[model samples]
Target: MAKKADKYFKEDKWKIIEEGFNPDYGMVSESIFSLANEYMGVRGYFEEGYSGNKLIGSYFNGIYERSEPDYNHYKGVADFTEYMVNSVDWLYTRIEIDNEQLDLYKSDFEKFYRELDMKTGILTREFVWKTAKGKRIAIKFERCLSMTEVERSTWQASIKALNFNGKIYVTTGLDFSNIHRNSGENMWNCGEKFIQADKNITLGIEGTTINTGLKVSSNCKIQADYESMEEIIEDKLVAVKLCINLEKNKEQKITKIIRNLTLKDESQKEEYEDKKAKIKDGRDDVIVLNEELKEESRKWWENVWKRSDITIDNDIENQQGIRFCIFQMYQTYNGAVKGTNIGAKGLTGEAYNGNAFWDTETYCLPFYLFNDREGAKNLLYFRYKTLDEARKRAEVLDCEGAFYPIATISGKECCNLWQHASLQLQASTAVAYGIWFYEKMYNDKAFIKNYGLEMLIEISRMLATRGDFDKDGKYGYYCVMGPDEFQMMVHNNCYTNYMGRFTLKYTIEKVKEMKEKYPKEYEKVVKKINFKESEMNKWKQIIKNMIIPYSDDTLIFEQHDGFFKLPHVDIDSIPISDFPLYNHWSYDRIYRNDMIKQPDVLMFMLLFNSDFTKEQLKANYEFYEPRCIHESSLSPSVHSILANQLGKEEEAYDFFGFATRMDLDNYNRNTNEGIHTTSIAAAWMNIVYGFGGLRSDGEILSLSPTIPKNWDGYSFKLTYNDEILEVKVNKEEVTIKTLGNKLIEIKVFDKVELINDEGYTYKFT
Candidate 1:
């Protein structure tokens, strides 16, 4: 309920809002953030100017992996761990007002604020400035949403002068080197720009990459110039115009235009102009595709509302928060490749250098599986697409089976052994867990056998080969660094042990099915791996009885064996200033403390949702919530969701809000770098799986709704078993609806199952 009085992002549902005078900086993000799903997406970003901490990452579904110089020791082993740096960011141009850089932070400014309105979809930024001559001015900016180009996007900004007015200068140009080292790993090479531009107004700005000419699939032209009393127009590949007007004691308005062009058409300038004319005249053009894009966005969400449960009620602000969370998550999924999973920031922020991690398997995919099962299925396909690379990764390591990349923009294992570079085993299970989630969400024998089963088998193969068994009759999977980064060189991690159990079960089952059904695939894989029948026996033995450390003394799960030998410190005693102590505290300090950057056992419990008993889930949630430092951007939301499910309402609210408001409130004080996309997606999952309680376990779609007190009511849709259903939930009751044709059943509160509902209402969990 405190969230109601809090001055922060107060939306509980996702709505497309329309607005004007949206500042370019926020608009670029809003537009980029105003992403959609139809197999691809990119947050619309400004191609020019002083946008703070902007990393405009545009990614294609399943189109990653740089095979050139293998980052992993493996040579041309079909690495799926590489996330290639692909396009040009036209949104970053330096701003020098009167030759004095108008660095907003360093100015004698009175008023400054920014807003990203998802309702109607617009971005706005406002600021008051006292010029060098002591003249006061106000600036308001806005940008438009582009459903026009699915991959390409557009943005615009308006500047104004209020009170004392004076002539001001604004500069717009593209910033090319926004790429930073992800996870502070390898030094990434800033690819060259073949296209060059030099203050040529008539032609706008244009250039080609020096080396990466065709690497990028799309080309875009974005331009902005200060508006005077009239409109200034420039024509070349795209139309760009700046409109500025001065009001008496008010402000000035400036707008930027971004035009997306097709890379397939490498036509001459005249050809592009002719195409533009035809488009204007209603010829074969992108405008039609644009229309479909809008339908896709609407239809996508509409279909989503069909089966997903909604738990928050009337408090529109909280309602907006929930929808916005889910909407953002939907925007992040690209579905074509396994390596092409959502980022830490989920396309919302450029921070974390926009790399994929355990977050995808551990947090994201489950939400997608129940609500958007097709998308979830595609996530598995992504892993399968990279299976060759996984195997090649093994070859490079002189091992059998696949070893997926820890962090990558492309599918290759680009992560060096540093931060989580050491948690390579977690990355391996990411694919393995994804396979498990798929099976849990959809027990479709055809889907599993025809598609998922193979990928599962391959990934399971990776674990079987990668995991070393101990001598004791009780089997243990080894050589894995657990979630506790401080406690390195670990063995018998409970999480890894569980993953091996899951892998072995699925791998053995899938492999056996293939051997019976698709003998050729079974024979080929067997020949390729030189796998013996005894291997299946080994997997069965290990899976049936893997040793997991239990602490009857504490009634909590140990991170792994020998974890009790480590010291314990109260996480709450730590000060906020020492946030991100992972870098400040000695590894020993962390190892000795009862703090964690993210979930270890809890992660396993959530990902393998049905595996743990409710009491176990509750116990883990209570014990870990207190000690969790949430230093990792991906932490709070997960705990929030779990807490909500366990009736830890207050804890759930805090964590959920923390996840939602992280960047907006600067909760972690790290927003200056960029928003945490991975955490943002986790925040959404915390809502869907935690509060909305939507989980599909191979057959039954289940719901356990619990709205935070601050939220009035929330509603969402899900596409389950080809049926479209919508669920609305509030403090008191929940509603369900079927938007698509199909007779299907869904478990409400993990108890009642609803069948073929045109719409149905039931008591809330």
Candidate 2:
């Protein structure tokens, strides 16, 4: 059966709270409370240890290990795959009172409470332990990844003896024995360890076997009011044991400040050598103290709230949901580091092998574009850096130019399934869209000329060569899959063809503009790529002849050629146990039916909403909404946005919660795998694009806001055209006010209005 939201968490405007611990929902809670700061993420597993179901995930972005591939004679199949490997357990802790180690699964506990503070980026958990000898001890654990520092994490534990005076022992340090859950393999080889007992500090370094040049160094400093301390070093483990004398009703706090630095042999050799020399020379390992790190992260989160917070007045459930979404979005990625993109699970879990998909551009980019433009540029820049790998992938598939991978960790195609790895075209087109979209929002023409235009030209080349004309002389992609995974190897998938046309047309337009406005720089880029006039002519020709399936009578586009001829299955009739059909049903059985894994035609409609009329959107929404099973985490929010656009308010709200609480409620029964990072972005899209009526596809920023029935009002912020605008929607009217000093032009219900410091208001009819 599909999992329902466990609802174990208490609702609050700025926190996710759990009053009593439920072992049945342990993994789900771990995922919901996971903490990350772009640089690293750690699942909310027990620091004192849990014997029950749990994934001890602590991941660093861009650090990955490659696995041997199953050899296949097929040409387009991937020969090997690389995945993000599980790294150091920075929160590893062991608490011992009278030699009885604290284990939540085995120990007696009361008043178990945990909360993830959205406003401050801290996760706190506390419980009272009843020892075997009838002594009670209260313990609290708090952790936060520094938002400002990026590479540092602070873990603090407070303990008090409630009944009797006793000695409590705490062992904590960075542990490097983590295993990749999917492969059941420990990929790291412990390299070096240093301990300084007098200073209460330890450092360790480990390197992956396959990707040996990738090394991670963890330096930890222990601070506590303890009676004694000792350094303990073991195989693949480095820790310090602290003995603290506790008096009745007196609390003692121990803090572990950790800083992790990752280095690649290819890019960071000098920096790595310098750090190694410093460690060897016995220099102090620098780290931000706990309170200082906490303060810095507090200011960082405050700024994030000032710029990105969405306020929902009447519904605390959704209010908490949306904040949680925004908080996770920031935690997953803040663009602090270059050469990194949002993973499918965003360092939350091991699922998707810690690889990024097309969702980085298609779904996650808008969130960052509106909140952090620099970060958005980094996302696109990662693609540009990986362009050579993309070109190699296209050559492997017997095509020209760049073909961005379906999944990647270090910019190489890693998905093993040939069907998805080779046939899907959205990944390439999504990169082009990201470039176009980024330029549209920020008006950074230099970024396009310097970095984006080259990628766009190569992507246009890939799409042009990858597709061909049918016997009827109509250009379309054959044997391909669109956004909907359920229908594969189909010809003329409307979404794919339309996006291809968009990519080609956009690339052509940019090339012409560059030639006219910046002829000198344009000539340099053109010469670098060996520019040919014929290729541009061919792209224009393909754009003109691209076939997008549509029906004039119904005003509804067929999802793909022969899609209507496929036998239909009643999605509602499917048993709950059969959900996530990939697991329960035969693989071939899924593709034979008309059930959609996600939006295909509706996806393009949303991406290019400005190009379609209301009647066309309504017609397609009515026709396609029923067939979607929404197996993908990115599905529901797209439906929600379109439903709101069509005035189906009730249906829109129905799908809204699913995107916001997909992990919190554990609706898909897969939260154990990881947080749905893309769906988290979609939740933001639901509020801003769905209910707030914001559309960026057109020239002028537009809005046609509608308040949900349960909401008293809602407000959100958007960063556009180098200005921040606060948009508020209530029952009576919609308000748009610039947070900056500049006047902004926006379309409200098809009427143009100028908004400034005083704001512009449009009353509902």
Candidate 3:
């Protein structure tokens, strides 16, 4: 056995590099170096297009198209809905010299390098190539999506002739041929295109889906120093050509300014304007747009890094990995818009079909809440806006309350699996938990009165309908799925039951508060939803008798009904190649036997740490971790956080390493499809919640910092309750400082210290 080398471009506190070209790893690198601005994302494929294996993707957060055969089942159990469709390909460039096209694969090329500058949210590539006809040229390119403008991006390419003085031709365009790579059906239909040629070239194309009927438009204008001409070639491809005569060692540069707009951006149907007119308006401002966007994007990233940056002092690999995870997570979604949640693959690639999942509430929301509270509020607002759809889904399932979909684009359940999509039920609880988590830290009563209380009440109502009293008079849920997808149709899943109990209890409290504080709002909600006043008694009854499975002998909670009765084979017994049993064995075989894909019971215990004792946590973690295959990228961070809490530092670091490198090292061997967007946020959790031991209990923020053995120290900033605080831990002492002018109290290793408006630092000895 041999250890694999860590893959990255370079070791910097602030930059991500793909040091040299790895054509074999081209697609993976594209995912790693992907760029986004919370609105749109583009993968890092070559600008001078390659015929090699790659997914040329550009995505908008809410622009999607529908597909048929969503589920493999025979019954009409699934809904016909749109998944996030891959948008236009805006990075097409064809370079030719002396009648030969410049293909990196076929040419003599060297000094190939690519970098994603985190500081400015820009991606750059540089290389030198010798054409087959013996003409040598050097090329450098830079690209960025604007964070300030939110709808604009720029790509600039500079070409220099080193040895030959001859004619050079370049073709650049907004391409729709490679819009989607789906196998089943066309996700987008070509609609209309408009082009104009002058000193600069302007092109616009719009498409509507056959199923969803949502319209999306992308427009671009090219600016260059050479003579350029524009044309519409294939009804789908809009191209601009540049011709130049270059002298020895002379350089020529071309830049494209692009703007993307979709109907999703419109607040109302009548507000939607003509796509052609919008395209023309964008081109009219092309002179100063690129430079202005560049500066604004830089400033936005600067503020983001100031508030969210985490610095690991000694380990460069893990340091870079941690930052890369944070960078990508922020790039994917900033919680900018209401009614839009992050996808499993984000905007980077089309994997998971760009449907929102429970991962957004459970794994990704905390990151945004801690750094960008308004963004976090917007994410929850998405769920709030979709509440009516969830209620309708609950009716279809014959459940009493809203049944949040397992995966969705427009609030409809797109996943076909009955157990996963319909019965996982904990997803509803997760949304409730997110609300509670936010309210506990911020205590925004207006939010609860206006939005949060209604959601909690509906979810709690669902739980009351979903569960029943058993023969032993214990209320419990049956035939459900937990976080561990390997197990299905199980009874009394502890995670689901406990979270249901928590939601019911929390909802009761919030309703009482709402009635006392805002009687008018409470009455309005009651009238709007037809919520029964007597449902309170049902919620209390269910909460009082919720049966959570546990084992007296093992001192650990059971994952579900009869889980221990199965023949258990520890993961160590399986061959390394035979691991991730889902890939190697039949579903029935893996299902009947005991092999945990991730920590189901342990995850519940970790999230609700105060409920369980340390000894109990250790017992359950020890029992389940060895059996965990960690097939889900979401697995390792949970294990890592629990390990750190249980004082198993060695195990904690190992699991942290696994999570931090999940995408960077392609540990799951699936990075080619897309980076695991949720897991990236989980990696950040491993550092802050795991190593930093940060916890909030509705009153005070607390930390029990434990420095990793290999590191000198680590520091991170968090925005808590509208105040910024920094926590830095070294071998000997822990220091907490408030960066804002607000009085705050935080418990350090169980000791409370007050930081005042004067801004003070508290040191623990």
Per-candidate clash tally: 98, 1, 2
> 151, model 2: CA deviation in Å?
0.9
Give per-residue CA lDDT, model 1, range 110-193, as digits (tens): 655555544434455556667676656666555433432444344444555655444555544333333423422221222322
Model 2 lDDT per residue over 423-487, tens place: 99999999999999999988898898888889998898899889998887789998998899998
Pairs of residues at least 3 apart in sequence or in different chains that clash in candidate 2: 5-665
Q: What ranking of all candidate models by TM-score puts the best one first? A: 2, 3, 1
Error of 1 at 475 (Å): 1.9
lDDT of the candidates, in the order given: 0.56, 0.88, 0.81
Q: Give TM per candidate.
A: 0.75, 0.98, 0.96
RMSD of each predicted structure: 6.8, 1.6, 2.3
lDDT of 3: 0.81
Task: Say which prediction, candidate 1 or candidate 3, comes out ahead on TM-score.
Answer: 3
Which structure is stronger by lDDT: 2 or 3? 2
Error of 3 at 76 (Å): 7.6
Rank order by lDDT, top first?
2, 3, 1
Any runs in candidate 3 off by more than 4 Å, and if so which? 1-8, 70-76, 79-81, 228-230, 265-271, 274-278, 281-288, 551-554, 756-765
